[model samples]
Every structure is written in C-alpha cells, then in structure tokens.
Target chain A: MAKRLMPLLNRVLVEKIVPPAKTHAGILLPETSNKLDSGKVLAVGPGLRDKTGNHIPVAVKEGDTVLLPEYGGTTVKLGEKEYHLYRDEDIMGTLHD
Target chain B: MAKRLMPLLNRVLVEKIVPPAKTHAGILLPETSNKLDSGKVLAVGPGLRDKTGNHIPVAVKEGDTVLLPEYGGTTVKLGEKEYHLYRDEDIMGTLHD
Candidate 1:
C-alpha cells in the first residue's frame, strides 16, 4: 500500500506492516508479540522546534530502517492497513547492519 | 537512591523507580504492568550528532518529568537499584500538567 504524508512538525506516519514471523533466535513469534523491529521510514515531519523557536532538522530521511518504541503511538487505519502516527523523538535508532 | 551518570552521546541515565500503583482507568497496576510513566530526569547526554557532524543540543534538562519509551534501554544495576541507560531519542515527551 502507498503511504500517506503527515503534515506537522516532529511527527512521522508509518504503515504498520506485520513483522517477520520468527526471531533471530529462531523462535516462532506471533503478531501479538511485544518484540519491536525495524521498519521502512514512510514519511517524516519537518523536525522538532528548537529552543529558540526555529525548526531543528530531522536526522532521519525517508526509506531508512528505524527502530521504534513499543508504546505511545496513535494507531489509525488507512483503508485496510493499520498505521501509526508518532513523534520523531519516539524513534529509538536507525538499524545498522 | 542516588543516580549514576552515563558518559556517552545521546544517552540518558535514569533510576527506574516504580510507577504509581493505579491507572487513570482506576485499575491497580503492578511494576510489571508495562505501563510507561514520567520520571525525574537525572542526567542527559550532550545530544545526538546532527547530519552535519555537529552536536545538537538536548531539549531536556535535569529534573524534567519526561515520558520514556517502554523498551530498548540497556538495563544496568548500580549498587542496589536497577537503572536504564538509553538514547535521548527514546524519550517520547516531557510530562506537562
């Protein structure tokens, strides 16, 4: 599914695709698993507001594999797909190989 | 317990104090409830490295009540208490009244 754009500062819109069914430990996991994984960055906001009221640039770009936190995102459904809209600060780190 | 400092970029050292017992829904939750809460900011890193290779300033200061992500922090025990050391990006927001 094509991703929609989010218009706001510090917000990111993500298409919640189901993660792979197994872990690196080779254990079978389900959708309800609390494990977090990396996802393709669909869309990002301009950035957070700096202390001086200027916009601080975002470190991440679209299409990066990012690690997200387990909670606090607002979940929404777009057509038949579930997506999350959260602040960029909620993103933990970029997954490196 | 006194908090120990973590030396690194983007890392925040927090004392993992147990959350308040009840939820807004009036349910009594335990420490394993998986509910995130606000904590007194003990120590924070200088900040993350920006795209330009410069140190970006941290938005949070010591003593701010911040919302932390549920997972991804490296747990450490200093003395008799368990604490977490994580990146500042894992912090969701500052808790305001």
Candidate 2:
C-alpha cells in the first residue's frame, strides 16, 4: 500500500497480518505465528483470460481481508516490508467484519 | 485421462506432456524433459465462489492442453500414474488444436 507492487493476471498481492501480542489464561498468547491464514489484500491483477478471451475479473479487491494459504506464493520486497503474490484462486477465502 | 480426479474450486488436474524421444542432428532429443510446460488437462474444478457467492467458473476445461509452472502443485497418485493438482490461475496458458 505504501509502495506500488501490482500482481498480474489472476494474481493478488497481500501482506500477512501478523498477530498482536496478548496474554490469556496467565499465558503469553500469540507468541507463535498462528493464523498465517489471514492477510490484507494489497493489489490485484487485471484478471486472466476466459474461453472467449474476455477478462474474468478477480474476486477480491484491495483493502479486503483475505485468507491465505500456508504455502505457495512469490515473495517480494518493497521499501522494507515483504509482500506475497498469490493467484486469486489460491486465496482460500475472504474475511468479513 | 484415466482417473476420476476432479479438482475442487478453481483447481485443475493435469498430467505433464512428456516429450517423445527423437533424434536430431545425430543427437537424441527430448531425453532431458524439456517443454514440461505442456500438459493435458484431466479434470477441472466447478469454479470458486465470488463476492456474490456465485461460482466464477474455471478458465480451462477438461481435455485442454495447458502450460504448467516450473513448481507449485500437489502431487496425486492414481493407479500407476502420477498427476498434479494446480489452481486454475497457476496454469500459465492453454494450448489449442
């Protein structure tokens, strides 16, 4: 978001939503990288071609919270932070408030 | 083409098109597995859900020749043959007759 790094052709750009620190049941919580499944959508591709060669728009839009797969993505760096490029389909699901 | 391995929700099943052996310039060609990019589509997902909750329909259909990525796929075994499961977006392109 601070930098421009757009994904192409059914691909989506996302940054993993690292968990916040907390304490629960007298235990320090979120010490581990859990919920790697969650990420913030950054940029998206212009959609891939369809049978008739028309674009079949990507499902998620920028600023949307999305579910990410544990594996599979092309890591990229911008400024100082890292982002990932995942095919829109590889994104497992979308999160809503 | 011999198994029932329907890929789920934007997934596509494919078997790499291994090049046939041949001789060229007194050298045996296709011995090193070049053009692994080509594949035969076996089965495809019924498409993934969209923002509206309707299926967005997979781009490629069964029996289409497709281009495969160098990596990133779940290997599957059926009988004596091995197949691959790729998200439809991971498929780079489709080959036509």
Worst 10 residues of 2 chain A by lDDT: A27-36
Model 2 misplaced regions, further than 4 Å: A23-26, A30-35, B1-97
Kindly list the per-residue Cα lDDT of model 1 for residues A1-97, writing each as its tens digit. 5446564787777655466577678878655543444456778888775555655666567776665566778876767777777777666555444
Maximum-lDDT candidate: 2
Best-fitting candidate, scored by TM-score: 1
Output the lDDT of residue B32, model 2: 58
iRMS, all models: 11.5, 13.9
Q: List the residue pairs that clash in candidate 2.
A: none
Cα displacement (angstroms), candidate 2, residue B41, comes to 30
lDDT of 2 by residue, B1-93 (tens): 123443446878789887656655556674655645688988777786655445689999888999888888766554346667788888888
Candidate 1 chain B worst ten-residue window by lDDT? B1-10
Predicted complex 1: DockQ: 0.05
